[model samples]
Target: MNSSLSLEDFIASEKASLSEAMQMIDKNTHGIVFISDEKGVLIASLTDGDVRRYLLSGGAMNCRAIEAANNAPKSALSQKEAKKIFHKRDYVVIPIVDKKGRIVDIYTGDPKEQKLFRESLNVPVVINAGGKGSRLYPLTKVLPKPLIPVGDLPILELIMKSYLYNGCADFHIIVNYKKDLIKTYFRENEAHYNIRWYDENEPLGTGGGLSLLKKEIHETFFFANCDVLLDSNYAEILKFHKEHHNVITMVCAYKNFNIPYGVVEIGKDGVIQEMKEKPLISYLTNTGIYVVEPEVLDDIQDNISIGFPDIIEYERSKGRRTAVYPVRGNDWMDMGQFPELEKMRVRLSSE
Candidate 1:
């Protein structure tokens, strides 16, 4: 849960500089505070995670702390009062400010206790775990792709966290090859989630298996692949979907793959029209994450192996708005290959 900490309660001296902020980060006791002047006008705050992101981004000892700070709680709410509101609103700490409106502190509020809005538990996330990880090769030969351990945890766990962090708790996992192993393992090490399993007796494509999910699914929810790692806040995506009233929202990322030599473009006369250096090309790639309404299940053919793209194209032909939310390059990962698996393990472990 995010803290509803306000700027007022959280403000420390930004002038204390990065050195002082690093010390506080090392202690992990008090969140680094920012004081505007050498005096005591709290302007900003910093947390250990903030330091971690900065550090991972090659931050140095002399780097400015103000640049890395989130500065999120921009609302005009008091510390104590904001805390109460956040609790009643089902959010953790919300930033607050002093009466002067300069950033000051954070408020610690718990939604579980206050039962804010009692958010209707309608969102259902579906993860496609039915693929045979042919790309991962020998490692995946013994274990299912979802069960592959990237670091301290399996890939599926990490994928689930991406959705869980977005306030999604209900999950429908489609299992096929080695289904027993998945079921047995989760049963032994139970996660605090409402997981309703959908078993595919025969191998089915992404769209085919999704059709068999329990009839309880109601509102729009997200669907993700087991082999992809997407670092995003689902709440943001959900809000975007609602504001746009989109029936299908696909998460896309800017990606570029390299080619070594210069390329030439020719015209009809076989004359070189353009010769350019190894120019960088950008692509908006499908990150294998999607936001869709439950009505989409109706398009899936029962007991068929239909890939998701077929359904997406079907929706496109129907004139439904299939929107794409483009994310930055570093936010998405494809761990289907050996090199990518190692890279992801390193990145996640470092964090």
Candidate 2:
């Protein structure tokens, strides 16, 4: 199909939320979303990279789309000139605006028209599926947590496929509690899986499993918990991790919560300084996904039970570079609990 987008599908209001802007970008089939004023005048442009940087800098996703947009965007004054600029700059898409700054049309180019060179990344994935899922209770009694079905497939399979889509197929799974069940399921499944099993003799915390991978993985790899699912683009996560030269990159989600009651701040003289009623609070929280460099594996002590966070802290103490990539809250789901698991099932079924 051709790649031209309708005005409504390509343009978003400047006051629109970040989610709305993302939707417009997705609908347009192009990477850029144009922000327009009430009169349909183009004010700014937003790209996926712009949004990523804004979120990384702690920008709230609930804020106006313009807050993360490029106010000074390149555009052509005429359609004839736009084609020239588009070809010269090799832009994916460029907006053509009139004298009044309104986007009259867009110059669209098919990526198929150009020569593209893409290479697959060879990165191993490590999943910490060892913990006894006490929270999942009765269900955990019969089957391992990784074997639990999300929809048609087990949660662990879904996690593997998520990485598989990004050219990462090699997997190292840490198994302890109900390890036999997990191994059995993978063995019997029709689909061939490339997996190396690491059996922990005893309970090892999240980061402890990496001790087994010290000799196996010699490149950048992905580490994740078996219970969480993130909808963000995995390729971009890897790109960001490598660009920053980080020893470890944690994937975090920005969550928003509204206060249930009014809050007041008072000065020392008992004078009310400010008051807010049910204000929205936003925070970046860990989503249990990571991009780790191979050298960091040396930091893990042998046969020690330590959580991933402790290892991150230890690396920081030694002046290691640790960064975070923030994703929208709705893009992340935790299937550890019954409530969340049900939520994920419903959401996936709809998709």
Candidate 3:
């Protein structure tokens, strides 16, 4: 276990802002953070999932991180003890504290040591990489959006590996704009991906391209946008879909945005019923990811431009079961827009 990281690197004050805590968590990249009081005594612990659940449960993002921190965090008094707990629990990271409950060091399990126990999921993943990526503009003008580098790998590779890590091997990629560049890149690299490419003769909107896969895929499969990545267990989502008997499971993110000013709710007579300060709002936004049973493919009209959302609605209208699987806020990262792309670049580069 490496103890090179100073306690300051992983410790945050109880009063620290949620945003600050998130940055620390991101910098740590260990999925866990320690929270302490002014006296430098450990008070609580926060994981990326905890912060996300807080926000999803109406906790303000700008509020203190302590609001979401776990007061009864699992910890050990010494490094030796911590190691035992870590191995027994298979925890990714553990914090060590002294007699006074002040964090002295941190212990992290080596990922390399866990390869033999890795769980592999045998599911087909479909990536919609056909969009022009107009949001990225000049950058997309030269390199296709999916090929644009994030850290060392392109966005598409990251999306693929997220699934591959969970045992997914086969892939079906739908491409249209700058299709040749994508095919050529994959051809030259000859990466480990078992890729099958479907070129859209014309820009068939998101769901329309699925018509090409009606014959190709028969089982439940993952469908995702090339520009988004979810830092989550793919197998859990699949299990949820199967257990619930959903025809389609839409993966969503719990997003929180604050209203800049007070807003009033009007009554029937146009009189104000209630008013709120710069209140924070939260909602489950679709992350453009789905686990779909092949039967849903029948709703997609052949070669017609229909967005995925429309397809979902069409399925619902036909009495198909659809459900939403919500992931933490930090778990979902979108690189489709300019600002988000830049943020994702910095975050990925750090990793």
Clashing residue pairs in candidate 3, if any? Answer: 120-167, 121-167
Q: Which candidate leads in lDDT? A: 2
lDDT digits (tens) for residues 100-122 of candidate 1: 65545555554356532332334
Native-vs-model 1 lDDT?
0.70
lDDT of 2 by residue, 1-351 (tens): 133546677789878887677666655656778899999899999986787798778786677889999999888997778778878877767888889999988878655565332235668999999998889999999888998999999999999887777678899999999898899889998988999999999888989989988999899999999999877678888989999999999998766667899999999999999999987665678999999999999889878999999999999999999999876666788998999999999989976
Clashes of 3: 2
TM-scores for the candidates: 0.66, 0.80, 0.78
Candidate 2 ranges beyond 4 A from true positions = 1-34, 55-64, 72-119
- Candidate maximizing TM-score: 2
TM-score of 2: 0.80
| lDDT (10s digit) by residue, model 3, range 11-49 | 998888776777677556666788998887888999876
Model 2, residue 312: what's the lDDT? Answer: 97
